[model samples]
Target: MLDYHFQLTRPSLDTIAGILAALFVIYSVSWIIYTRFFHPLARYPGPFWASVSRFWMVSQIRGAHADKTQRELHAHLGSIVRIAPNEVAISDPDAIKTIYGINSGFTKTDFYTPWRPAWCRYPDAFTNLDEPLHASRRRITNSLYSMSSIARAEESIDKCTAVLLEKMASFAEAKRTFDMAGWAQMYAFDVVGQLFFSHMFGCLAAGHDHRGYIRSLDLLLPILCAASVMPTYIRSLFLIGGALVQPRVMKALTSLKDIDEAAEQCIAERHAQLEQGKSGDEKDILASLFAVMREKGEKVDFGRTEVKVEVYVALFAGSDTTAAAVSSVLYHLMKSPAVYKKLTNEIDEATRAGSLSSPIQYKEAAALPYLDACIKEGMRLHPSVGLTLPRHVPAGGCQIAGAWFPEGTRVGVNAAVVHRNRDIFGNDADNFNPDRWFGPDAARMDRYMFQFGGGSRTCIGKNISLCEMYKMIPELLRAYHIELVHPEHEWTTHNYWFNKPSNVETRVTARATGT
Candidate 1:
């Protein structure tokens, strides 16, 4: 009787497993057929697998070349490609002004929903999907991050730059080949730290991740990238597993929790310092945030929670993205010897003439035309963030890139695709020739930069990155002769969300006169 009961239950379990597998297969097949043939986006060009399921897009993103792959698809499929069952990636630069323009009526899609931290009262500017809220948040302290406002805090950037140069100077003296990309990111974090709390993280001084900031980014970006490709339920499953296992790990790994706690500490410390008259009158970004809240009153929705969330967002977004940009620029400069020489010559000339400050100034850097072209070319070649900003089409359907996109269709423009458009940037768009910005159609081409995005909803913290890049690059070039460790090979990069380059190992030699 016992043997008979065991046999009966085993078969019953096997039967149930078999039934579930068969049902899943049947459902998958039906879903694929419907999505590929009956879906509205079915008529559009895309990978058949992509049309069948979002898993195709997820796999592509996880494999870490979605940007390059999408670019190739657009090149083959023309300006538009159905990147998901409900989403289309439009490559034409003309799609920029139409989709992202002020009052274009295209609202940010759920793709950005995951970017907001769970602890925040309202989403920070980068992830805020609510139009009114985003606009209000931007209005509250947008001026504080403006190029003019950032330039006023030039000493903070200069301090960060000085620390970075000193580190590079050590590498030069020791004649050691170090990972410039890692150092660049470290320096960027320090810059944000200095700008935000009136003190650097001492990452450059210590020569490391410095409180596991970069490690948290390494962990966080992939999750955010996956969230873009997969369903929220699937993402929840991932987070659930991580939530269970991560906390139980032997070693204490840096997570978003660490960053949040640190941000809160920063808020308290800044408040104490302000109250004690310890903080100088220069007004760091945090100080400015407080000033806005006090002066504007409760009519403005900016509060302590909002300030903390902004701190976390700005620290990660400002540092990670800016680091990517700086790394890419430096890598491209290393790759293109002639262009690199030309830019350095311009900076050196300016420096020797006593026109440029020791660490360079944003205004002075802006005056260098070749340097300007190089920066633009670097960004165009490799946008810092290798992801599309998905926006939902409004009611009554609209046209884009000569194709009609129906209402509720998710549409976006990827810089990786749009920047390489042969029609706009010319036929040699894929190449790293800075002369494109100097061409007769330069003004027209300038409109398509799209790195900081376009129109009213553009990145509010963009000036912070530009402030650092414009000042730091010229100063670094003036200070050292940076040579790539592997000049013949392209620097290896991976795009989780930010298209960060990690293979930039370089040897720095101090420039006598400039130093």
Candidate 2:
């Protein structure tokens, strides 16, 4: 009787499995039908697979071609294209104000949640989506990134710039080829380190990614990109799985953990120094943050974790994007010989006129209209961040690019798409011409340029980045005649979140004075 009962139950288990499988198929079919025809966003033009599921978007992101794909889609589908079931990419310049402008009802989407580390107890300004919370946090930290603050912090930047030039000098002396992108990254990392923690990561001094931090950053981008499009529950599952699965997931986790540990260690050391009666003499960003905390006294709203997150955001967000911008400027300068010559002449004229100093001050560089134009053009052609900055529509819904998007809809502008809009940028939008920025439509172009983002959330670190590039580009060109090793070949880029360049090999020598 026991054997007969067991045999009957085994078939019952199989029956249950069959029922579950049938239900899964039915549910999938229903979801597809609902999203394709019955969904509010179904009327929007998009790829068929994209209209039905987020799988296509995720796959493209994972493949590191999402930016290019979006650009192509926008080119063919006009201003708006449904990249995912709930998300639309807007290429219209006017939509920038509507979606991300000051007091715009659109809040950040859940896409940024994964940006805040799983271990973090609270979100930093970058990861915080709540308007009030972000505003308060931004207010507290705003002065640290203000132009005056950055001007004071120029000493730290100068130090890092010196190290970078020294490294380039060595390459120039040896007549050796080097990866410009790598050196640019080293300079950026060290600059942020010096500015934030009063410590340099030694990437420039050591002549490589000394701490493995850069490599870790490169590895983590694809993971973050994939996580950005996943649903909240699925993303949570990934986090849980990453914690449990030691080997497979640990690789990515370790990279992020290393960065986190570095930040924590820096904070601990700073606290230790404070306990030992060490007064900070340098006007670094950390010093400024500490000052604010002290002013708040017992009512201090933020703590060590908050400080760590801010420093982490500074290092993580600041480094790669700045590096890419610097690299882009150099790449374009090299590609367009006339532009390069014109820029060199301007730098030389400034130097001869006793206007530009050695190591080039930010103010002096700012005055060089041609240099400014070139920087703008470089950023316009190849914006560091290639993905759409996603935002969620408010409860009442709104019109964007002349179409109404319902509440809870995701809408964003991709810099890659917006920067190339022929209507705003002209017919030669694809070309890299610095003169375009000096044209009558220049002001109009600036209005549409989404390189540094827009509105209140505009990158707080924008001044610092511009200061670095403004100083570094002129100084480097004035010192060395740099040439791409393979001028005929295009440098490869991997657009995860930041469009990072690889194999930006170049050979350098001292630039002939007055030539």
lDDT of 2 at 202: 93
Error of 2 at 22 (Å): 1.4
lDDT of 1: 0.84
> How much RMSD separates candidate 2 from the native structure?
1.6
Best by TM-score: 2
TM-score of each predicted structure versus truth: 0.94, 0.97
Per-residue lDDT of 1-515 in model 1, one digit per residue for the tens? 99999999999999999999999999999998888889888889999887877788788867889899998898789888998888899988999999999999888887777677788887888778888878877788788888889899989999999888888899999999998889889989999999988889889999998688778777777766776678767877766675677652212224667777778999988778778988757478888888877777488766788788878887768787888888888998998999988888888888778888766788889988998899889888888878788899988899998988889999999988888988899888889999888889999998998988888878777888888899999989998999898899778788877888887889999999874
**Residue ranges of candidate 2 with Cα displaced over 4 Å:** 119-121, 242-248, 512-515
Candidate number of the best lDDT: 2
State the local distance difference test value for candidate 2: 0.86
Q: Which stretches of candidate 1 lie over 4 Å from their true place?
A: 1-23, 245-254, 275-282
Least accurate 10 contiguous residues by lDDT in model 1: 246-255
